[model samples]
Target: MSRRYCLVGNSHLAAPKLAWEGVRAEYPAVRAQFYGATRKQLGELEVKNGAFGAHLRPTSKKVSRAVKRVSGGSDKLKPGSFDAVILFSLGFNFHQAEAIYRTHRTLDFNGSATAEHLVSADCFRAALRSLLEDSLAVKLVRQIRQISDVTIMLSLQPYPSEAILKDGWKGWTTLKAEGDVGLLQETYISAAADIAEAERFDVIYQPVDTLNSEGFTKQDFCENARRLDLAAGDVHPVKNYTHMNADYGERVLQQLFAADAP
Candidate 1:
């Protein structure tokens, strides 16, 4: 019987396509599957691409819908339906916390507020916690456990390119600003810890360390830079950066699968 693996989550998950393309080029015998939120269908295999632009809102029902689609709408697959499941989610929803507060004026002490006042520290923290409970972290854990014998890999996207930052800062400064970055890092670490404590599943850590190797920091990316005219300055990494993410995914997959091989 052929083994199957499923890759799911937001745009960060999309990076694996580049990596998979590389893998296919290097090892044509390997058969794998990828499901992301962007373009649907990979070669002859149909991909349930669920990635949408700024669509990972904590309160959005799409999170659950994505999970359901992957699970075959609760129609039980044969045991070991997926040999592995890789998740590249979290950062976008985390970043969205700030966008949410800014749009809702959640931090406005008075009804009238400036853009600076919209991103207050307290509001950011509140947004982070609210997003955590309602969106990415826990939802991912539950989804992974449902698929039997599946080796689950939870990896985060690299920090956005220096171009994504609003001002010239590495990241936001208010409690909310710092928390947006801090909490997402904490959540990834804590979620890995929680999963390890609870089960035998594999959880891979893809931190900012690799991006740092390029001498890029959150501040560098956020500071003044030419907007990526392609997508109107959305935080998605450009092709070169996406290749970096793909390399990280390839290394993580090799380590995990090699270790598991008998």
Candidate 2:
């Protein structure tokens, strides 16, 4: 029997949805349906009992249309019907995590702690983990479990763009090792996984091979990338977008399916 997957996300579903068309060609037995809305448009929808329910208002026509279209005219998703649920870009934003880490001078010792303590990876790891555990993204995974017990995976995009790979001296280089922030990245991912695991949810990160030594995404996989151009004199040095093309999406899905294999 063909396995059915429900693709749910905001704008992140686009490339994956496009890639799924080709993926279906290779794995013809698999089928998928997508439900998506931009953040600006997602406010009018709510999860109710394993499906999306409408928040009908005078301004909710667009959201209503999306739900109806994706749910096959049903007011909510059909329960217990899908074989799996793959939510893309619905987890912690590593970009934001990096920004927060940079903005806060978290290592000030006040002459109490030793210099080595200030640079310990554990401190940075814990800080990032705590931040991720409380994010709405982590909470969403829990909420989704409240409605469905099917295989639910919390998908994170590749850690960050390749452009930021070498930008180690913006502010917090002392806390990192070999200019690699991967330890901190894993901390956030691990914290998110811990939350999801409690609810029987799984979290998957970009394949390790897709990342460069600095733990940023590889440029070859970023075919659809664009530069991050900040204002004059601003310090945003990253030159790539995290959103990828269908080719990269295919690779991601292939890895996901391989992992799901027994």
Candidate 3:
């Protein structure tokens, strides 16, 4: 029997959904479906009687339409029925790390960089763990565990485009200026690994080639990125660094379905 996989998350799920169309033929033994909603609505997803979904009814007309559109006419998924459930972009992001770095300096930031609120390595680790544990991704994982013991995989929100630095976002600018972007990347990887071990899920990071030397996604992969409601042609505005185009998705999926991937 073919493997049945469900990809669920917020808007970032768009990338994989679009990419899956071109690559599904290559993986004849695998079957995949997508379920997406806005970040806020994602939290509304509930698992009941071994099925998971947002409630679709008259009062939630907008969410109902969104569910149908992204899911191709389905509102719920029985994760126990699938071979794998990959959760993508449900609020695990590098920005949270940046936010921490902005307020407190850790030993990881080399050189005489002085911050009034320098934190011990142990304190820093505690903060990062707190952030990840509180994230929507972790919460959703715990909820899923309540009903299904299926394999769970996680993919973080795609790294912001390198164009983000050009736009002068304080988080990106500060990290780059402090020579801590690389450290940021390492931190993200390490934190992800720790979460996977603790939570018992697999993680799929962006393909290395898709990232620039600074650990941000290459600008080329971000142009003309679309929103979750793709059918409405909800393309992101210019200089939108957070979202990615289909090309980015294709590469990530290729890595994911590779024979050796977890």
Candidate 4:
């Protein structure tokens, strides 16, 4: 029998979903399903009696509809419904760690020699680990384990587009100008890997080609990115740097399945 896989995420699910939709025919031995919601709504999802669904409330209608639309008309997912579950970008990024660096510099930072308000390396690592532990992605993984020991894979949110530097975004600008961008990227990836190993899950980091020299997603893949609320083929506003276009999605799919292949 073919292995069944479910990809569950927030808005970031759009890329892989659209990519899979376009190229699924070439992979005849695998079956896949998709489930998506806003980051907030994903936090509200719960598994009840083996069924994963939203809580009953006024917004439940909108949430369920969106889920159904993206999930091919299925609004609820059962824990054992698939052989594997890939969690994509439900607050799984280095944003929290980067935010901390905006106010404090760590010893590993390249700019630390001249930087004020420096923090100990231990303190920086601890803060990043704590934030990752408390993230929605981590919580969902733990939640799924409560009832079933399904295989879980995590795909972190795409790094912001390099275009962010052009705008002088405080954190990106600081890191670009003086901080060790490479160290920050490595620490974030290492922390996530450590978390996955401890939890016995897997992680699929971005493909190397998708990253620019500064470790952000390339600007080419950043154009015409879609939002969760947009219809298929629609593009998000130009200012949105976090989402990615289907080309990026296609590469991600290739990376995922290549690693997953027998």
The digit string of per-residue lDDT tens for model 2 on 92-148 reads 667555655553423432221323234445565566666666654555455556566
Best by TM-score: 4
The candidates, ranked best first by lDDT, are: 4, 3, 2, 1
Model 3's alpha-carbon lDDT is 0.79
Better of 3 and 4 by TM-score: 4
Q: What's the distance in Å from true for residue 67, model 3?
A: 1.8
TM-score for predicted model 3 compared with the true structure? 0.91
Q: What is candidate 4's TM-score against the reference?
A: 0.91
Per model, state how many residue pairs clash: 17, 0, 0, 0
Weakest lDDT window of 10 consecutive positions for candidate 1: 38-47
Query: RMSD of each candidate?
Result: 10.4, 6.6, 2.8, 2.7
Instruction: State the lDDT of candidate 1 residue by residue for 1-262, as single tens digits.
Output: 3446665545555445455667765544445554443212111121121333111212224533443343335312222446666656544233454355344443322322434455554554555555544444345545445534457665544544543443334333432343334443454355445444565545555444444532234333322222112133433434332223455556555654554453
What overall lDDT, based on C-alpha atoms, would model 1 receive against the true structure? 0.43
Off by over 4 Å in 4: 50-59, 114-116
**Model 3 Cα lDDT, one tens digit per residue, 1-262:** 5778888878888888888888789888888888778877776666565223322121256765777788898777667767888888788888788788888878768622666588887787779878987888888788778777788888878889988899998767877888888876787778888988898888888888999888889999998887888777778988788888889888877776772244
Clashing pairs in 2: none
What is each predicted model's overall lDDT from 0 to 1? 0.43, 0.57, 0.79, 0.81
The reply for model 1, stretches above 4 Å from the true place, is: 1-3, 25-30, 38-79, 90-130, 140-144, 147-149, 162-188, 195-201, 207-209, 213-262
User: How many clashes show up in model 4?
Assistant: 0
